[model samples]
Target: MYDFLIIGQGVAGSLLAWELAKAGKSVFVIDKGNPYSTSNVASGIVNPITGKRFVKSWLMDEIQPFSLKCYREIEHDLNVNFLSELSVYHVLNSVQEINDWSAKAATFHYEKYLSTSEIHYLDKEKVRNPNGCFEINGALKISASNFLSAIKNWLEAKYCYSEEVFEEAALNESRDFVEYKNVRAEKAIFATGYDEFFLKKHSNVKFSPVKGEGLVVEISDFFSENIVQGNVMISPTMAKGIYYVGSTYEWNFRDELPTESRKSELIERLKDTINCNFKVLEHVAGIRPASADRRPILGFFPNSRIGIFNGMGTKGFSLSPYFAKHFCDSLVAGKALLPEVDLKRFF
Candidate 1:
């Protein structure tokens, strides 16, 4: 019998599997091959600076280093370049905004990341911006597809992955073990994304889903080496001549299908930022499994023979590695968990 059986192959599942397997624990992953899952479409932009005030990221100091070490080690093991060190230019929208950024740069601990030099990539003549741009440090762009692909290959090499959908009927749970199909494991973990239809079974934990929509635009004239941010962000993808521009956060609607109104909204915003001819390559949408509080939902089920490691939310790429290790240590070595992120948040 294996040590654990994991449901879903998104970032949460992938990272937990990596941590458990690397620790010599037997693990298996089951997924439905849903390309539209949130993990695949995520721009994987892990920024240490965000929002209107330009404050430091939530727990920036510890999370970034852990992510760097983990992704680098995984890169070596998988022989893939998935992480790129990149700076984001927080395009100040107005003179007042620029002044606010300048003041924040003076006292803000992350001042080293902010820059006043004019960006060379942007067209100075066409864009309608009187105020200059300021750059910030502490941003890393991760390619979700690349990272997930590497994890899948590693798991498949051990014969621990299946592309079939997971049915609740297939799961047999006891006080200490879970049986599924031909495999029996001492424990089971659920790491599914916004598809938390099974979460009702463990009603103690609370998860709020947020719908996010992004657009892919192909432009010949607009060229930038750094992530551009103002109302929306334009992050570079590995695909040539293409960039992922997004996103809109909607709390009311949580559907995977792209809406025409959302698409139009994104296109109009894109036109306001870049003065260039471009084509709308694709429109993608997904629901994020954001918790009521910002921290992740990491703990065991309340009444049954199962566990869950989920709720990475918008910070999935940055938070997954650190917490995956934490959860695995708690399981394998009887380690204590931080009170803030512990599953007891709901209680």
Candidate 2:
């Protein structure tokens, strides 16, 4: 019998399983192996400051350190190289915007993450920066696709991973244990990303999923050492002269397929961001499981051994590692989760 039967090998499940397995708990992970899953295509840009007002991201002060440590540990454990410490530059539209950033930079709380900055690594001919861009310190650009693949390979080698769809109706649970097919476990965790079919089984929990589309482009003249937030983000991938640019967040999307209209739309925005020659290699789309409240959900359903550790949203790379440890440690110690992120909020 395994200690965990985790559904989905996305970041949420992958990190949680890592935490459990490292703590001497046996875990079995099942995934559909969809390359287009939201986790696979996400740019994995951990920006400390975002938006026009230049306000700090929620929980950046608390989660960044913990998550970084966890990711480095995962790198060592899995024998993979994917993490890269980098900066993020946000375009300030006017003198007022730059002043706002300058004011925020001098504050005590924002000192480490944001400093009075200037444009760097951008070409005057390539990018139209009239007011000059402010740099964001403590930003990260992780190769999430490579990281996810490596984690799965490690899990497969340990005989704890499978590429298959998990049928919710087949799950069997009693007072003391949960059983799925021939595998028995003390508990189960649903870390599936934006899975409507599976989430429908539990109507009590509410999930607000958002569809986003991005592009993989090869650019020769323009070079971005870090992620640049403009009309969209032009982030550096591991490969030379290749960048991941995107995305349009559609609150209501018909399906997860890439449409020609959106493709044309992204190309136009890409042109607006850079004044250089580029080739669009691929267009990708995925629906992310975001909560209406915009906070991650964690905890168990009442009167059941099954639990959930999902809703990391766009910040999964920075949120999952720390929260996964928090969830696992809480479970082992029989403690309660934070009221804000606790599942009872939706219940």
Candidate 3:
């Protein structure tokens, strides 16, 4: 029997599998290969401070370093470069907002992530920074699709990956283990993003799906190594002269399809942020597997052999590595999970 069977090869599952493999446990991963999945379309931006209030992301200190370490190790293992460390410039909208940032910069906790120096406008003619901006340290722009692809390749080489849909009807459970199709494992983990069919079995954990849309644009004379964040975020990709500009969060949506309305909204915001000549190259959308309390849902079923690791949400790139290590330890070494993220609270 295998140590674990992980369903879905998104960020959570891939990282968990990596951790388990590092612990010398046999693992198998199954993925459906959704081209427009959130991980595929995500800008993969990891920032310590976020939101209009510019508060530091939860557990940034602990999670950020772990995530970087994991990604660097993966890069060495896969012999590919997908992680880019970049500075993020938060465009200040008003004098009051600048004052708020300054006030927050004075705090000891915020000082590490917040920059107190005068913000530099890379292109004064092309970019708009009327009230200037603040620089955030230790931000990352990961190529999530490439990272997942590398992990999938690694799993395939080990003969532990299958590109197929996971059917709930195929799962068989017993006291010692669970069996699915021809594969039997001591435990099963469902890391599928926003797919409620299997998750419905755990009625206590509520998932809130948010459909987000992003766009790729080709800009001329916009040269900056740093990511720009205003009303919208514009991130540089590996492709020369092309930038990923996004994104709109629509809580109520019909499906995970790109909408012209959001496209126009993004373009308007982009134009407001910069005066560079640009054309839309691509538009994509995906649903985020968020939670009601905005924390990850992770734990085993109360009376079954199955477990779940979901709800990394918009912060998946930043949250997955650390939590995956934690979950893996809990699974393999009988460690206690963090009380905040434990699914027992929902139950």
Go through the candidates in order and give the clash count of each: 2, 0, 0
Model 2 over residues 1-347: C-alpha lDDT tens digits? 99899998888999999998888899999999988888998888777887678888888898887877888887898788888888887766677886888889889999888765544545668886666677888887779888899889989999988888888888999888999998899999899878888678876777788888899999877787888776778999999999999887788889988888888988898787778899999899888888778788898898888889988877878888878988988878766788888988987
What are the TM-scores, per candidate, against the unseen true structure? 0.94, 0.96, 0.98
Encode model 1's per-residue lDDT on 70-184: one tens digit a residue.
8889999889988888878766677777777767777646655664444323455534344646777768888888988888888899999988989889899887789999879
Question: Top model by lDDT, which number?
Answer: 3
Candidate 3: C-alpha lDDT: 0.89
Ranking by TM-score: 3, 2, 1
> What is the TM-score (0 to 1) of candidate 2?
0.96
What count of clashes does model 1 give? 2
Kindly provide the TM-score of model 3 when superposed on the true structure, using C-alpha atoms. 0.98
Whole-model Cα lDDT of every candidate shown, in order: 0.82, 0.84, 0.89
Candidate 3: where is the Cα deviation over 4 Å?
none
- Lowest-sum lDDT 10-residue window in model 2: 115-124
In model 3, which range of ten residues has the least summed lDDT?
Answer: 115-124
Model 2, runs deviating above 4 Å:
117-121
Better of 1 and 2 by lDDT: 2
Give one digit per residue, the lDDT tens place, for model 3 in 50-169.
988888999999988998999999999889989999989888888888887888888898877875656555556887887777888899989877898999999999999999978889
Which candidate's TM-score is highest? 3
